[model samples]
Target chain A: MFTLLLVLLFIPFIGAFVTAPLQQRKADVAAVIMAGAVMLAAISAIIWAGGGRFDYSLAGLPWLTVPFPLFGIQVDPLSSLMLLAITVVGFLIVLYSAGYMSELNKEHPTQAEKDRYYFFTLLFVGAMTGLVLSRNFFQIFLFWELTTLCSWGLISHKRSSVAVQAGFKAMVITAGAGLFFIAALLIMYVKTGSFEFSALGQLPPTLRLTAVIFLLIGAWGKSAQLPFSSWLPTAMEAPTPASAYLHAAAMVKAGVYLTARTIISSQAVPAQAGYLMGGLAVATMFFGLILYFFQDDLKRLLAFSTIAHLGYMFLGMSLGVAGSRLALQGGLLHLINHAFTKTLLFLAVGAISCATGTRSIKALSGLGRKMPVTAAAFIIGALSISGVPPFNIFWSKFFIIAGAIQLNSAWGWTVGLLAIVESLAGFAWFLAVVHRVFFGPASPAAAAAADPPPVMLIPLLVLMVLSLLSPVFGLAIITRIMGG
Target chain B: MYLLNCLWLAFAILLAGSVLCLVSKRHKVNGPLAMISMAAAGLLAVFVAVQVWLNGPVTAGIDSLSIAGFPAVPVFTVDRLSALFLGLIGILSMASVLYTQGYLPHYKSEDPRRYYPPFLLFVLCMMAVVTVADLFYFLFFWEFMTLTSYFLVVYQRDNKKNLEAGFLYFFMTHVTSAGLILVTILFSGWTGSLSFTAIPEIYRQRPPPTRPC
Candidate 1:
């Protein structure tokens, strides 16, 4: 088990170094294989655990033990589930890029930077996997900062003036917010003499509240939940697959996962802290939903959708901290479900641009007949994201709403009611976009468009079925988690 | 175990046919292979599902391969719920694979490699997902079914958009699968076993939460 954990952790880092020197073709193949290997190792770890937890730490990490066991791995059901999502999604993205970054690509037709793209992408995957498995605050922080570095590299992969500025802006905001994370770590260490996640529970009342607030700021920034939300949309300047991975599966998820993990590890978190989180999260959710009306670019619209979904997660987590296990389960499930849905939306847009040479909702129409697979995939994604039934998000969102109602307070009712309003409004807007872009009569751009290659279509079809079936498994897991 | 025998036989035919599809160079040959395998499997699935529906559940134990650490675990148990889903899979798999026979002629530029193999494997996985009694194997086949369908969705490799669509499709499915997997673990943790057989006894012993309403 320990050996498998080590392999899972090191394989991507090894791939990053190995792929850096290889030519483009070799690098792409190697990176995909490497990601595939990481995914296999993660699965092996799951089988090895056999429904139990594994906590493996090196006894001889002498210098690294200043405040914590920074070099250990903790593979509970939570971390294992996260590891699977990260590695599996990472592998698919790399496979997609093998075709997506080629000269055949109509959206951005150049094979100029495959090595760099694979290098940073692999590093980002590694960092996310590591972050999920980290047993201590310092370890999580290291992986956390590594993710910020990788996003900077990936977001600016094209190095256009706009891309560079967007990348710089993302780095400045996230890394700046990361300072508060480390500061919180410092506070925990000073007050409790440990950097274990549980140390937050040991801090005195005043400092504990302060640390929680500081951590929330870090989560907000990384997740791009309002006030820190601006960078995500601009970060859309990155290549589509990178946007899909970073925004959907990796970077943004890191924020909420951290918050959820912290809450899970700590005890007796204050009611006020939960209220602050719930309040900011609801505001962010509403704020993101309102901005959906303004987006012309498909990616920007999806970006706002991501922001709103992240807010949903924060709301769920806050409710969990306030004593609703169902909400926590739903929040975690949403993290996984939204990754697939939002990534599908982003990549669908990528496919649109690849075929039609434009992502402008106003510039494209009647693409359904031409690009049937993409159109179908997009429709599924849109409906699923808007909380339609039998799709993935609907189930998680249902639990979250139920959780709010279960809270049964004035605050809960208000947030639950507002969430319902947001869901309906989001459905309306997404359906509008779908009708205009896919269902209308063909414009010139749509006339020339068609479904993508077998390489790309495979992932979309797989995701479509996943969207449909996710509720079955999502409910089972959440039910068991809540002991229902 | 007669139904179980038919199920295993169908699985073998599909697996063998898919391997042939991958290796065969001629589209004409691949089409017939896919059609034959899918038809045989679909008939078997429907027959087994009907048998289970009429005569109660079908149960079988694979002496060779049990879920790891749980040696007595049954590998195939088709209860009514599984039978219903299996029947659906049978109909859909037959219809889609048969449809592809007519569909393949239009895409002259495409390779048969992209479609027939994945289609067969997709069917096989779907069949396995419903038939497997262990939660782990159910999820494993469920995920495999998702993975194989991806190849079918992106049959047009030249259109970059299809590739993007495929990626998006895959990203969503793969991630959601992690949920079912987690549920399986939780089930095992609670029941001390990985088979569906353990579920009823555990639930009987411990009552489920009452719905608030």
Candidate 2:
């Protein structure tokens, strides 16, 4: 069973390898197989790990030192949840890509870029799995760099000058972060004489602090926190599936995961660091939300929204309370909700992009009459991200605010109130975009557009349903994983 | 001991295959074959990594070879942490290889098959950095990984944008590596041992010997 978890981690790579030789027609089939395998693996891991914290260890072989100082793998509740999230969301994104990529391919009949696009898509899933499942810093860094590389490839898949430029920018920013990550790992190894995370926690306070700060820097860069966040909005040049996978489900969330892990494993930082983290989170949330309101590009609006939500998670971490726990839970839960909701929105955008060849909100109107399913999915996603009642995001945002109020600090209250206002403002902006695009008079594009293929619509519909029902299941999962 | 040699052999084979493709002008099937070999080697390395992860640390060496009388015995050790990293390298490299299959075709018209094979070798270098127990070997693999990746980043060498991206990547990576090397040397200088196992006691016994800052 442990081997199965390991296999699940590697299966996407295997699937990716198999897809390399496949023809254009077979690429989608290959993608489905890989995605299905990931979903199955995730389900098995959840069952095997038994919904609570459990650790599985593999024996050392004779070739390597039996107690190899640097080698380890463990699956606890947190990682298990992450694994499931990556796989489930990854599967849907892959499904959505089949239609989206096929449509893009048709638009460029003279160009033969379909095979390369699908291949990178499959590989991205595999790289993400590696990232979430690995147990030590070294492995994490390796997988982290892999994601940067894969992202660059996917972002540049369009072969356009703009796409290439955007891909290059993303690579530099992320790889810059990757350097800090390697430095942190080496420093930790030197200080503690061990690279395993389990061992690092046992190190002296000073050493632990060193490791934590370095790791936090790395995480902040990857998660797109404040000063390092500019690359995320620019990353919108890629196809929608790439955007969905990179922004909502996998890449950006890695930062939150790192911070959560560091906080859990290490002792608290000094009050200064806490305040610094908190201040940045607050600023990022407000700045990102404000910027989101100014975007005419539908996907860019969502990109800014992602940055803002990431800010909320960071703010929750800085608060440090029983409130922090609830806040973290809210933050993490919102991650799951955002994954579904944002992916749905991106898919809808992709469908519209396909029909009209534009993502400009100003140019799109009355699409609801033509692509009603997509329009409806977009509405649900918009509502969910905006924290409207009964949606999963609402519950998460509610807990975040509740956690803030519990802190009883004036700053906490202020940030919490501002967060709510910013969230509502962001929501209104999204609603305006949806109404302007889907509900008003038909634009030239909407008048001629038809529904996207079933391959795409079905996935969007499933995500919509998941968004609707997530609060019920999300609460249960959080309870089980957090030992509540 | 023999198992350790086999691991190195696998990596060496991958390295050789990469070089073979780079030197060959024909460019047919070399890229895919290089990827396959690297993938297989990565899988095998994963098995080794899992073992170390479960048990603790495993060390193996063959003494027959002599490198300037320092004993040319290439040693491989997988500690609990290194095993995790090894597994990650395998998984990541495997995926990259798969993507390269599709990604390479985009460059096939331009005869850029040389890039894929070298990229696989670069993966091996990264794996080596995580698993090599000796400081010298670790540094060797670290530099190799950086250089190889630098080349891969410049796959679009004719394009100024790609060249600039590659330059930035190289600059950032080397700077980080310098910091890492300083840390590694500091610990080794203080402890007088390059082995990972020997450094913990040194750090434990000597408090504030050198401030980390």
Candidate 3:
């Protein structure tokens, strides 16, 4: 079973390598193959992690062994679930990109950069797979950095000066965090005589505290907590697929995963760490939601909302193990839900941008009449992200708020209240965006624009349906994985 | 023994390739050549790293290979952590290099060879810094990595913002390196050895000093 998990991680990388030499004309074919590989990998990972019987292994070469201890990879319950989330969402986004990018390519004929886009997209999926399945911190960090590099490429894909600047900012901020991460690992090695995560997990109290704090800094940067939150909004300069990838599915989730891993592994770390995490999470949530109210760009508003939602995940994970167990499960489940819902919204936005040639909220109006299907998908996604009932995000946010209230601490109560306030603020903002863009008098562009091609619209519909169905599957996974 | 040879070979190839690309007249081939050499080196490093990751840290030394009183230091130690970083470097460099194949055309009019190869070399140097176990080797690679990347960042010297970003990045990374090196030196002095493997046991037996440094 663990071996199946390991294989799942490498499948995308293999797919990427196989498709790399394919000509630019073969971009769609390559993308489909890559997406299919990811989907199969996701299915296998879910089944294996769901307690199904499966096992396989490739033996290490005997001659290369230097009599040193080697750490083999494992796919336990946690990794299997994460891999499943990454692949399912990643595959859908790739499918969505096929139609969305082609439309953009046609509109800007000189911008026929299909090869570069597909290559990096495949690379990103593969790297993300490696990140989730690796049992060792080293492997995780390797994949983590790969995701960073891949993201920089994606963010700068538009090649505009603004996009380039945003990419550079992201690189520096994340790379700076990477340095702190390296320092933490080095210190852990210096103290424990090993870099293996299992070894570090057994460390004494003081060492554990230091490692945990170091890990938190890395998470904070990657996840866009507090001071690091600015870059995520800037990342909206990327294409909608890239934005969805970074915000909902892969990159930001790395931070949540790191925090969860550290807290779970270091069981004896002081309660102070939890308190600190909770405080930061609460602060970031309110700050993000407050900022979201001021944004006029549709994507930027979503980006800020992403920050607020990330805060909920962080806060949930910080309330100690008992509190965090449910919180972390909720957080992870939210990540999966966000991937579908956000991608749906972004695809719809991309379609809207194509037809209207504008992203400004004020300039666009009454798109529902022209692009009815897209408008409906966008509404579904918007409602789900706002935590409306029966949607997957609502369930996860509910669990997080309930977890906070159960903590019975002043900070927890404050966080719970803030969660409600932030949700209301988010809902209000969404209503404003949707109402202004979809219901009011038709703008000049809306009157002339037609629906996007079915290639694009179908993916949006699939995602909308998935978003609606995700809650039931998510609840079952959470209960099984977390024993909630 | 083979690990030391492999480390030296990889470093020599990287140094030669970077220098060639920096000085070469034919700019068109420079990026590809540098990428190939790096890919070779990175692949070897990954092989060594995976071994370390799966088994344990591999340690080796070519003692007294240098004439100076200082011992001929170990050049490479593939511990589990280093292996992880090595894999990251391999994967990232591979993608960055491939992307550069398409991206360099945008900069071809401005000496593509000089712009791209140095960056690849810089990435290689960063990978080396993460894997080297000895303090001297670590610092050497660390400084080299910073210098190469600094040049790459400022490759667009005509742009004032580019130069400013480069300088800022240089200053920040140097400051970080200073802090890291200071800690390394303190650890070395405390343990009376530069080998990272020795420090953990030493620190375990003797609690760290009043202040970490």
lDDT of 1 by residue, A2-120 (tens): 88898899999999999988767898889989999998998788767754668888643555345545578888766765775688778878887887887777779988878999999
Q: Is the docking of candidate 1 incorrect, acceptable, medium or high quality?
A: incorrect
Q: In TM-score terms, which candidate is top?
A: 1
* Docking class of predicted structure 3: incorrect
DockQ of each: 0.04, 0.01, 0.01
- 1 versus 3: better lDDT goes to: 1
Q: In candidate 1, how many clashes are counted?
A: 21
Best by lDDT: 1
User: Estimated TM-score per prediction?
Assistant: 0.72, 0.66, 0.66
- lDDT per residue as tens, model 3, A155-263: 8988999999998888888878878788777776676666556555667777676777777788888989987887899988888877887887788888887776666
Superposed model 1: Cα runs more than 4 Å off? A59-68, A471-484, B1-213
Residue B28 lDDT, candidate 2, scale 0-100: 56
Ranked by TM-score, the better of candidates 1 and 3 is: 1
Off by over 4 Å in 3: A1-7, A21-25, A52-71, A103-111, A265-269, A320-324, B1-213
Please identify model 2 stretches exceeding 4 Å from their true place: A58-69, A103-111, A203-207, A267-271, A321-323, B1-213
